[model samples]
Target: MPEQFIAEESRSIGHAGRRELIAWAFYDFANSGYTTVVQTTLFNTYFVGVVAGGVGGVSPGLATLLWSLSVGFANFVVMFSAPVIGAIADIKACKKRFLLWSSIGCIVSTALLAQVGPGDYKLGMVLVTVSVIMFAYGENLIAAFLPELVPEEQMGRLSGYGWGLGYVGGLLTLLLCLGYLHWAMQQGMGEAEAVPVTLLITAVTFALTAAPTFIWLRERARPLPEVSGERILAASFGRLRHTFREARRFRDLIRFLMTLAVYQSGVSTVIVLAAVYAQQVMGFDTQSLIVLIMVINVTAAVGALICGHLQDRIGSVPTLAITLAIWIAALLAAYFAEERSQMWIVGNMIGIAMGASQAVGRALVSKFSPAERAGEFLGLWGLVNRLSVIVGPLSYGLINYWSGGNHRLSLLSTLAFFALGLLLLSKVDEARGRAAANNFLACGDS
Candidate 1:
């Protein structure tokens, strides 16, 4: 009887762990529909080409600027609010609640996009901006759960698992959108009508897939001291300030984040500009660009899985350095590619490097952050990630503008960001950073 009871207990633990991991990964799967369909593939173009023009009848350039401003404004909101919200979640032990509300906000806003049509550009912009803000917050909240689910040793692989799964989700969602678009066109529906349906599909997919995460993932962290409305605000800011001070004590973490900021800027720029470069320089059509993205998605998933294992064996810093080296090479390839086929090769290389760099970077930050304050620290991580969205594209655009739209020369500027990031990253002491986090937590507790 005793032996049977022990066996049952062990089995239950294993089952729960597996369930939790799947639930966590599903959030990534769920969100990728939004990322791939709305942000990446269809809706941005739909807005610029159809809604922006029909409604306000704005110039193409102004419409493009408005779209950019909406995205930038969303990032700005998240940039300022994420840390405070994270601190509040940490203090209140309500990360899951925050995640739930944000996910719902995103879903509702995205579903409402189905209502946007010709002459509804302003409405579309508002919905997209709100959805982006909610999505960004959900991303930050979900990532804070990583350290809780797995130990430091297993974090790299698990983070990789989540990311690889995410790419798969993105790929699948993109394929679904493509199929829908094709069918809609066959039925004599134009993009304006078809695009809204895709938005609905994305909303449904996100809500359904994210259900498991809300059900299975348990909140393990304990709440800090209870506080009321004004005190909550005061305490959250105070905690954020203290986090900055504590982070200074952990210099390596600070250095690593700085390095991440630099390299990620280049990475973000490459992703944002890749299709544009391919279309303008290589003269690839929409179909070819879609095929290229699909291929990249597959390679990215493979790279994430492979590099996750590499990170466990070689350590995050080294694995990341290797990935950065790949980025440098990929950028150089892009700069010099005179033929479309060569650009295709560069895209594949970028895929591999992109997946590995992102996965390893997140795991490295998790390994270095204080266990108790993971939310606040990862919030700061979100901040840097958002800031990179601004700096990277701006820098690339400036270079392109100055050089009379010389994209090849603009690509070279990305190389500079990667090279500087690599140089700064080499200086980070991963062990020392991990130790500093542990030591600070211990001293505070004592």
Candidate 2:
């Protein structure tokens, strides 16, 4: 290629045009309701106390075990399949198409959760698994859009902007659900009746909020020639194999992913269990549980927005390291806290750590990804994170079960994950990784 074209392409490297960036971030706003309502607060408790207990009369311990195992299974599926699907999306230039179908899958399944009631634990489990799978796919698909929207320098801010807004979305959804739950109980509805309605509310929120993403965000990658039809699957695997064979080029990405896997395990565990801990350990009832989560969302939004700017100035690794240290400290505080007031402090700390760590990790992956293979690589990032989701919750569930429901002891597992993550983070070289990604775009792809 001529030097003129290289110069022009370099000049074109900046933020997305028009409202594309806003639309992209709004997708985060759209999907967060599912995780907030279904995964974290309402449904998990309802599933354990009502659905699992109704027919066969499952032990609460066993119900939690089942819930954790189910979460593990769903993420396990995403863990192995995300890379191949991502590779396909890149080669087909159909990231939007794939995202749309996954969104539909999640919305439909999530709404169907309203149909679950007493004696419907099996149905609940199946729907939960399907919704989670769809949600994970959509999350990875939308993140693949990140590298297309901004240059590496702005990635942290953009990523942080989305996460911060996402927490607000989560907060709003929880407030709506909390209000409805309160009204339902006032109308003489019990937990069984009120909880399923919240699931429906979450589904509707996701669909309505996600529309702008499909309408406004453009698919920028051109499809690779001959990588269509039946060959798409073959090409996806081929791409994965090629990526692995080129391991030397992406060594830092590999290292950082290992770091992410460890730390995000801790994060995922907190997300999955926070409500349960509040309810059981902190003695929070439903209304109080919802309020606690609302506080977390507020703190998380602040952390994401503030640390995003900090990351741009100080670099991603340092920002991530700081968050991990916070996580370890928060876990220790949580373990020792005997009062609800103390747990509230610990919850806010976890929220801040959670938002910053997640935002920095996403932006750092964007820094390391080659432009043409952004989808495939972020898919790999999803793969590693999903695997952590499996390990994190399952480990916590097992500890809780083995220790006779001792949640305090189980909290130690999250602290260990953070410690391991911080150590592994030191091994990654951000500058070298960015240069390698740029060199590929400049020389290999061109």
Candidate 3:
């Protein structure tokens, strides 16, 4: 919307038209507030500390588990629905439309979260679930645009651009909310009053910031004529079944998705629980938590930009493998972190690994997806990711609960996922996956 923002993506990094690319990245800017504030930073702590804090004799450990369950339940719904809706979007050529609606759903749901307060954990959980489901769908639909915007080799850079800009956006939004929170507290209001205002800020910023995306991000997909006069719902299912039947042709993609599902669990765990960990274990208050995340956002953006370039030069599999290794190291540091200084270092490491891993993974998936089948294939990607979200966060919660609130033990368990993912990454053949997608593009399997 602003010239300064437009100039931000004009550095000629991503190999795409600057305007469209900037607009696409703006969507990332728009949605980052939802994840950064509502999921990762503020409301999670609110849900755990304020919303679920000591009410009805709910233990802190149980509250943490409940938060994890809320996230898991949301992903569980998306796991089954993502592919079907994505297939429908593909057949109808409405990825952008789907993206818009999901954003609106998330914005509205987030605004409604202001209605939640202390002892309203049930309502808070439901609203968050609705918001997250919308956010996940929007994430999938926006990512499906990747292969259309650039060639496979450039996908990493494009994905990185969006994620890098996204962190900047998240940082800015957090700062804005932080300023308000600080002012409110100075004026004698506490979290219960100030937190609702921050949610409103997030909703408004999400709306205004997202305007550029709908204004400039064009949908390049065309509706399939073969599906004419057919029920899109049935055709969507049929397409999914057909894709399943022909999975052999895309074995490399299958292999990579399997690898992604394993390691992304660690990513998911950190994303949903990082703020909780910082608060509960490291004793970060609200202001301190915001600052820590802001710092992490900076490193995450740098990691995305650097790793994006590396992926194009060396290859996606190796780059992703390297990031997963970083994740293991980060987790080990987090597990042993006793001092706040050590936790900050751990946070930065996690941020770097997160940016690199997520950007490369999305780009790799795009490299293996044909343009015509982008939505369906990326939908499958969404399915695998959301499924992993369920497994990672829920299991971590269970471990915490069963171990009598031993968060360190629960966090340490995530190391297994990154290790498993790194091992699985070696099984992926990047070159073969790209060729398979190219072949499918030329000779339509339909």
Q: If both were scored by lDDT, which would come out higher, candidate 1 or candidate 3? A: 3
Error of 2 at 1 (Å): 37
Whichever of 1 and 3 has more TM-score, that candidate is: 3
Q: What is the lDDT of residue 424 in candidate 3?
A: 86
Q: How far in Å is the alpha carbon of 8 misplaced in model 3? A: 17
lDDT of 2 by residue, 15-127 (tens): 46536777888898999899999888889878876888545398767777788888899999999999999999999999999999999999999999999998788888899
lDDT of 3 at 422: 92
CA lDDT scores, all candidates in order? 0.81, 0.89, 0.89
When sorted by lDDT, best at the front, the candidate numbers are: 3, 2, 1
Cα lDDT tens digits, model 3, 1-446, are: 33543354344334446678888888888899889999899988888888887653578889999999999999999999999999999999999999999999999999999999889999999999999999999999999988787767667887888888888889999999999999999999988889988888999999999998899888888998878655888999999999999899999999999999999998999888889888888899999999999998899988998898899999998899889989999999898888999988998998899989988999999999988889999999999999989999888899989998888889876889999999988888999889999999789675
The residue-by-residue lDDT of candidate 1 on 315-420, one tens digit each, is 8999999999999999888888889999889988988998899889889888888878888889988888777766775666666666766767777878998999
Q: List clashing residue pairs in candidate 3.
A: none
lDDT of 3 at 222: 93
Steric overlap count per candidate: 1, 0, 0
